[model samples]
Target: MEARVMICAQTFFHRFFMINNIAQQPSSVPAGPKRAGEPEHTPHHMMVAVACLFLAAKVEEYPKFLDDVVRFTYHFRHGKEATEALMADKEGALKVEKDRVLTCERLVVSNMGFDLHVTSPHCKLGPVVDAVLEVAAAEGRTDLVREHKSLLSLATNFLNDSMHHLICLQHRPTRMAAIALAMAEKFMVGKEKIKPFPRVKVDGEMVPWWCSMRIVDDDEAISSDMMRRYMKDFHSQVYRQDDDEAIS
Candidate 1:
């Protein structure tokens, strides 16, 4: 019964939260400064508050930590604000007591669980390349298909250690494949590299700059049906442009 409740909660919350995220306008830029007249407990405040909460969850068995308030400060200031801003609001009037911050952090932890990690296209490069290959095969674009496959492998290799920055936790195989595919499409269609090829310390390793049309069949393999489901789910859950229309 507890397990069932957990599953149900996750499903309902995931649906609503994803829909809400979709409804918001997509911004390539980092979040902007808050309006001057924004209220104390406004959504922006809640966003900062939620970061504190997630930090508390990370420390406790729950989902946040007391120190997350400082983390929020770092994010807000982008390492530019004075330390005093860590204690009070921008106007220096609304002070956040440490105890209150801890309490809110606990509240956030209870709400979000300790699962802070999320999936991105970095994870799905493999399957996306294969999917593109299938599409390429259908189009009879052998050169383009092979090019995409090569790019897919290169992107996946580039991400091996960098995935830590993308998700911050252990890799989930299914999500990894989806992210890989999306990345492959981005490169193949855009005809550009998303990031510089990662430097290798090992004596013998393939480098993206030196290689062309190198085939990696194992990289194309998807592990399970669940992985495919996760890939599609993550794409739908996270990457829609028109939030209101994207959720449905």
Candidate 2:
């Protein structure tokens, strides 16, 4: 469920960025620029983010009530005291906020051209993990089979962490799955919990374990160096956030 929400949020932000870029483009017809302060013309970021999450929940088949979404959004954006006061108001602020969210939802859908289907790397993680384990078993490496749960958990953690960075936007789902598995295997090997991944024979040539998974075609084959570069960037982002939190 968390994975689904994260994937949806990533898709929402991606579409949001695209919409902003298109909106900023110069119009062919000469017209006065709308004032940024206009209430109708300017949508609040919080409202749009909540709307995206609301729409994403529906898309992921985990529908949430709009009222619950709005309430939670307010609770998170404002503190408990402020939200309670707003909810108690007779001026219909909550109703107005709900209306704004609905309006933004339409804007989001229109800007997205009604394309809401989003494929997540989480879906690919399972198959990738299975392929690796199958190869390990084929090589008479029973140790990996025994550690299946741990391996899957580590890979899942890596994949979830990847969602926090723009690396998801930079790579396809298949590539992200491969990277997650690679990171997991590397971490396990570093801890001496498992032997390094065994190479598999592919078309008479020995190839890395990921090569057997068919994550990408030969033309789009990723190299070890490339994987390392991606992992480095991923770690940097994660650690940078940790440092910021520590300072805070």
Candidate 3:
């Protein structure tokens, strides 16, 4: 069974690998005159956000339905909740904000040259996980390593969707990778989901039942915090390192 699963996975990756080579690169902001107070960005970073969606659909093979993308992008940019949110709010009558939606779509299309296809980081993330697992095995940390591998995969899946509207993919991968790994390790240590840890009631607030676990001690938390901090600090280091090497 394991061998069959592995073979299937390999075949899937091989197909994706061939397609990934020719498809568009990841979505990026397009170049434009820098706004006041904006840091200068590379041409690649400046590709319009809409282009990112184009890339995602092509790469993930799951394009956001056109209407859904336009509606969500407008709602997201304008801070207008869709009908569902307005229905939930009893304060005022809900009307479909057609003008706002139309304007947003036009702006996005104009900025992105109406191109909706692009490459996605998801294509590259698999190899990264494999490398992480290899390192984990070398260090004899199988328990924590396996947990981390799962966390990375989950985080990557989540980001594949989130990247549609985002400019930076750096932060999510780092922060989520750490958080997921920590949670996984907590689960592995006899802190079974069956006997959850005790929850202290904070005044007027209900903590979720699942979050009541005593996952990390204070000392361990410090290490975890340091790991997170390192990821945060290192987020843009890759870009900078490449620039430095180019100059050299």
How well does each candidate superpose onto the true structure, as a TM-score?
Answer: 0.34, 0.80, 0.31
How well does candidate 3 match the true structure, expressed as C-alpha RMSD? 18.0
Q: Identify the leading candidate in terms of lDDT.
A: 2
Highest-scoring model, TM-score:
2
**lDDT of candidate 1 over 5-123, digit per residue (tens):** 22222332342243244245233212343348954331223343344444533433354333545555455644545444554564332234344444444444455554534343343
lDDT measured at residue 180 in model 2 versus the true structure, 0 to 100: 77
Candidate 2 segments exceeding 4 Å error: 18-42, 213-219, 236-248
Alpha carbon RMSD to native, model 1:
14.0
Task: Write the residue-wise lDDT of candidate 3 on 125-215 in tens digits.
Answer: 4444454455446657555454655556554544433333222233333333333333333343444322222233334544321222222
CA lDDT of every candidate? 0.41, 0.72, 0.37
Q: lDDT (0-100) at residue 173 of candidate 3?
A: 37
Clashes (backbone N, CA, C under 3 Å), per candidate, total: 23, 0, 13
Worst 10 residues of 3 by lDDT: 209-218
Native-to-model Cα distance after best TM-score fit, residue 67 in candidate 3, in Å: 6.4
lDDT (0-100) at residue 124 of candidate 2?
A: 81
